[model samples]
Target: MPRGGIGRHGLRPPPRRFRCVTAGRDYRDVARTQWWRAAAGAWLLGMTLEYIRYRIAEPDRAEFEAACARAAVPLASAPQCRAYELSHCEEEPGSYILRIDWTSTEDHLKGFRASDAFHAFVAEVRPYVRDIEEMRHYAPTRVAGAGAGAAEDTAPNLYEWAGGAEAWERLTEAFYREVHRDDLLEPLFRHMDAHHPHYVALWLAEVFGGPEHYTEERGGFQRMADRHLGKGITEQQRRRWISLLMDAADEVGLPADPEFRSAFTGYIEWGTRLAVANSRPGAGAAGWAPVPKWGWGVAPPRRS
Candidate 1:
């Protein structure tokens, strides 16, 4: 008389299919039907996958592969380059593909190319430049992967999931309000401007994949970093600042889902730590760094 077919010793019985009388089908049948529907939907709204195809000559394939291995060093080190994979085609002997997963197209075009790493990367691959058949990025129209369930998430970027620029403005406004009340954090921002919250919103918006208004209107990352150059923020203050902001995120009705919160909190942790480092006296960190474009569960790699 074990409940739900559980054995006396606590061993579970085999899964039994219960029939749905209304639909005249078993539970497994319904599950399989739902799963296929989900798979189809996911295939319609695909992930962003970038591809770089190369067609090397038969004799030069070895040299090309060696060059690619060397070039990967600098590209792999780039903050924007998330995944760099070079593969040789099995059917076509000399055909190879160099695939890169970038945070975004702008991160590759504007950020990486502007860095010295690009110069080094280019030098290594220069010999086989002529052999490259196609070099382009692609955004998938549809994709399916493991754990894709009935609810096909279209995968909104952090900014969109956080409700875009207006949402960030609300978050920062509420956060600053809390900061003003917090005894530990208030002293650091004693002279903080009324517009500080709005500026912060723009920065968050840019970082979370909204728009580049912060960089276009303001001085971008350099200006933001320079502001913290000598504030001497303490560990206690940094922790309090992060805590207050997270509280504000909850208060303002931001997404409470694990994926969103993880990304959101991850950025706050990184940004606050950097703030603390930059606030220390005589820190020589780069002021002209590219504003990071954060995604679902990924933050940009810290530059050296």
Candidate 2:
């Protein structure tokens, strides 16, 4: 009987009649084979799968296989092609299957297939065009793997962990409430507006990875630095600012994890120091820059 052909009973004939092309062994046909069906059902829930099945003549088998490897290079580099593999059938030496996992059918069909790399891939395999017996895309009904249930690749940034804009609002409100009563810091903010806390929250939110509201709605870093020019901020005032903010962070439940607190306090120290320096008379204005993005135990590098 021909390989992979059905028997008189409507079942795949015994594998003994067929030779494994790659391994050069007799094939062993199994009953009720449902591997591909199960795989299709289990692995296609949220992803698209492209299946390409083809055959190569005896004399062209090796060259065709090499061409397939070369052809896959372009697909492998495409962001839409999440994963791919090529395998030769054990029971049919000339038979090959190419499986590519794509982010979406549109991503593969529209994005990758239209790209220059697709042309390159086609060129590599053009010689074996007649060997392609079947080629199509399939969507899996289910997917299971180590990373199948994983969340997004990016973790929440510092702003998210710090309870977002609302948390910063609470922190600023609490801190400024005390600032109004304090002998040392009150003088600097005596004329503060009723919405001072809101502005500060916007500034903090931008620095902590939340939004660009400070830059868009307000004047951003240059304006912030300009605020303190000629105020002659003292070291004692800087230290008090840090102390009060840390106290406010604690009172407002702003993520007391060691890593978080360390980053939070580090920024407070650095920012207050800069505030003090900028507050001095004759200090040059720092150029405009994006608000720093703080992370767990790290700060965005300062621009040159």
Candidate 3:
């Protein structure tokens, strides 16, 4: 006996089963049970073919946007596609996730991995991306319900005033580069390779829609800032930096568009409030914030 181990190999033996269990079962019954079990397993497998999810990381937001646009073309051409959309992480700016629905797993396999368009697109967008992870699910545990001819669903409300996705990307990127150049934001830039031409593939993706954008590991933003806070920033310095950002917005051509100007103002106001919240001692030490989904723009007219 070694150190209270019950078995020689330190493994527990299987529990004994009753004789009645085996004796009562005949070969025909066991075969039927096995067949039904296999059928159920096949049904579950079929459900998995209906849903697919892809997780992508884009360390740089601009190039990510470009890549997202580039990935769209082949995906649109893909025959198995029933529904699809790209979503940016609410909490993490540079992260992207793509969700898609397909009729069947065989159809999806035939359209994507086996398709010619996928190869061409991969060659075009592979350089900008860090990694892509994909999973197939038997059922969508979380999804919006299909409405019964009620109101039409629209794009993310936050993007309406910015004139859909394109305007939003241009204004946001130009504004970020121009204003957020302080040490607080510089680390992200340093981690990103701006001069690397591999990003051009990403640029095409942004223009067309392909899998070029890469997402970062989420969380830990405020902690990273706290480590360098007192050394690089003061209360007064932070305010000045914000003002410089507003100036940069003007420089980067955001102020020229009234919609972007208004949206920027709202963003600044919300951000200032967020900073105040973070400053309170021992308040939400996680330093997380919610992103609003409603847009500053007016809603589109409903069709009859």
Candidate 4:
């Protein structure tokens, strides 16, 4: 036990988060979990983090980013530099953080700073040096984890994700081929035009975030509803339609990732159900409705 109670009632020491020696172990008694602190500095990779924080006026933000982009190139090519990121604060737009990973502080100070890469890097960044609020090296906490990759990798919408218009055409064509052989669905489509597959492809493409050709060239929603108006699509036929489409998806090599498939299956089920209701004797809800733009239904594709 140390000396005083409230002013000295700590177990280990200050950084170890013990009570202020005299306070005894108050409500903040976290001394038992101090093991992590001791283990933290025993780094795994021995990497050093160099953080450079900057505060630039809003007008100069773009140019600052561009300058850092150029500077980052040399840093990336530097033998002692491992990785780096330059991020703008979303909440504080004029503030930016630049984090760099170096093999070691000594390598960054003694090796990288002495290299040609450093000269090139300094040339691009020198103008902003005065704006730097903090430029210091820190040991990695190891508790830090990576985030969702670089921001440049944007997510594609469902249309671009499905390999675009050509992929949808192949899918519909293959689907109709299966439909022609499926006894459950053949009677309904026995007279389906030779161009039916192509037109259906257009509709699907439009639904899944593609062009508006279906609405523009084809007569959009009403025309689509008109086709199934009197056929009285049965539940069995609707289910079989979905089955064949999925099979066609596999056969035509459509994306099989769970997210894409979930979104695909979602639209298929909703559309087929709507078709069934409209095909009934007097259903008219879909007659005047706009063509629905389908989205990544339940689970959108994972993107960085």
Candidate 5:
């Protein structure tokens, strides 16, 4: 409503909020804000942040970004590098900041500096060393998080990502439509129950971090394994099943993020491979095992 009073979040400045107006500036107020920030920074006690400010010409921006992308490979693999981000300045297009979080200042200087990953990282970014204006480590303060953020699910489970039971139902329904037409897999399910797809969907939902209805009402892994017994699943058919299911996933609009898709495919491969093995004569399928709840990158325990 008034000029010069609005803050970053579009709210009127609070008495406790930090401000930089020379007209009514109080040196004590500034000192109090710094004191509060340092005291609250306990959230990131041991971690050290290194902000590297770069002033690159407009022409060099593309090459600089590409170099940083290449350099990220080593940072991702390095033990001492906790996290990193290369950010662009909105107000000044020529300005960029590369922020990296290290496990500790000691670990970064003494540990990562001596590692092979650091050497590889340096080779990618050495050309821009002269363009850097600031490169130093600072500790994080309790002053974390942001406002007006997008609605992102921070839950670490695949079930939520797959959109629960209804999503699974859609997936199986679409998949069976393909299986019904494909000659390779059609004959295998020709004599199957009408509710086979529904049950299979339940199994999938339960396995990938959904509810335990498959285990609760329809029976668990043993029942599932027994269904495949003596079906004589072949490698060609197994691969075909995977293809149809993946196509169905696309058709049904499953989450296509790399992490989600990779984890989903990992489970599919595991189940299908085991199904092929268990369908063969006298194969010892696992029984009485607890139903697995798959997450971001977790896999079931090895059978052997």
Candidate 6:
């Protein structure tokens, strides 16, 4: 029999009412589950952290460390706080990184904003930083090298791959403590520490040269040299800082594999420019600006 809305087969049209009811149930279930999942996620957003990196001027490390220790303890034990630490960089002397982890972002905000002790600490340590360029906030996404259910490292490597990022953080902290002590680089940079001139020198030398590949090292080194053009940073200080970095890299098990070394060589070469540049500002960043001509003494080395 021929139907009004069907072909010769005479099948009935699909039931709109039945389809609507099924879809509505499914949509409601999905919406409800999504809402619950979001709520659960917010509850589990427990680990909030801030990584504050700085370069304190020379001669102020002891004073700054003591002030921070005195003022930081009260804020450290806040109900919302899980951990707090202050660390220096070994590879790059005079640089510091402070890591603070909170139970929740809300708790962290409350602790800093509401507490007088935290403010006191900030006031005490504020003068020490030449610049606090970056403060990054992070939440843990995954824990590497652990079993499906496990949160711990089963077999840690020198770099602590088994432990993951946590291990890296610990390695950096430990590396600094070993190298940047009274024994080395301290006597050399003492007067220049916390000085704006030194700050700008580093900004140009290490920070700028890494990726920019300044055609002449002068651009970067001049900053450091100009600051201490008269006082002078001895060649020994430069060499010591490099050695400290190398030792720290070794301790952290940063692979000295050929590939890594090749890359690092580039970094060192560029860094050398900054060092040389600042040593002689009269010429340029590299104190003695190399005037480009076709083969002055010997042919210039080819750029990689």
Give the alpha carbon lDDT tens digit for every residue of 1-304 in model 5: 1111112111111123222222223333443323222221122124666888889999998788888888989888998885565656656767877767677899999999999999999999999999999998776432332233311124445776778889999999999988989999999999879998899988888777577888887777678877888899999999999999999999999987777888789778877887898899887765554344444543322222
Report, for every candidate in turn, its global Cα lDDT versus the true structure.
0.66, 0.66, 0.39, 0.68, 0.68, 0.43
lDDT of 4 by residue, 1-304 (tens): 1111011011111221222111112222322222111221123225676778899998887788778778878888998986565655556778777767687999999999999999999999899999999998776331332123311124566778999999999999999998999889999989989999999999988877678788889987778877788788888888888888999999999999998898788778877886787789876545343456555533557755
Candidate 3: where is the Cα deviation over 4 Å? 1-59, 141-304
Ranking by lDDT: 5, 4, 1, 2, 6, 3
**What would the per-residue lDDT of candidate 1 be over residues 1-304, giving only the tens digit for each residue?**
2111111111111112322111122334433333222221121112223566678888887677777778888888998875555655566757766666566787888998999999999998898888878888765321212232322134566788789888999999999998999999999898998899999999999887678889888987778888898789999999999889989999999988777888788778888887898899997655344566555543222322
Could you estimate the TM-score for every candidate? 0.54, 0.48, 0.30, 0.49, 0.48, 0.33
lDDT of 6 by residue, 1-304 (tens): 1111111111122212111111113233322222222221121224666777777766866666666666566656566665555656556545766666567677677766587756765776677655686787665432211123321113222222213344334444544455447476666555544333323322322321122223234353234335544435466666766676567657766545554444444444545554554556364323322111010011112224
Residue 85 in model 3: shift from native, Å?
0.9
- Residue-level lDDT of model 2, residues 130-231, one tens digit each, is 888888877532122222322222456568878888899999999998898889999999988888899889988887667789888888777887888988
- Candidate 5 error regions (>4 Å): 1-156, 284-286, 298-304
What clash pairs does model 5 have? Answer: 40-142, 41-141, 41-142
What TM-score, to 2 decimals, does candidate 5 have? 0.48
What is residue 228's positional error in candidate 3, in angstroms? 71
Candidate 6 segments whose C-alpha is farther than 4 A from its true place: 1-45, 143-304
Clashes of each: 3, 6, 16, 9, 3, 14
Ten contiguous residues minimizing lDDT sum, candidate 2: 35-44
Error of 3 at 63 (Å): 1.2
Is candidate 1 or 6 superior in TM-score? 1
Q: Quote the RMSD, in angstroms, for model 5.
A: 16.5
- Among these predictions, the greatest TM-score belongs to 1
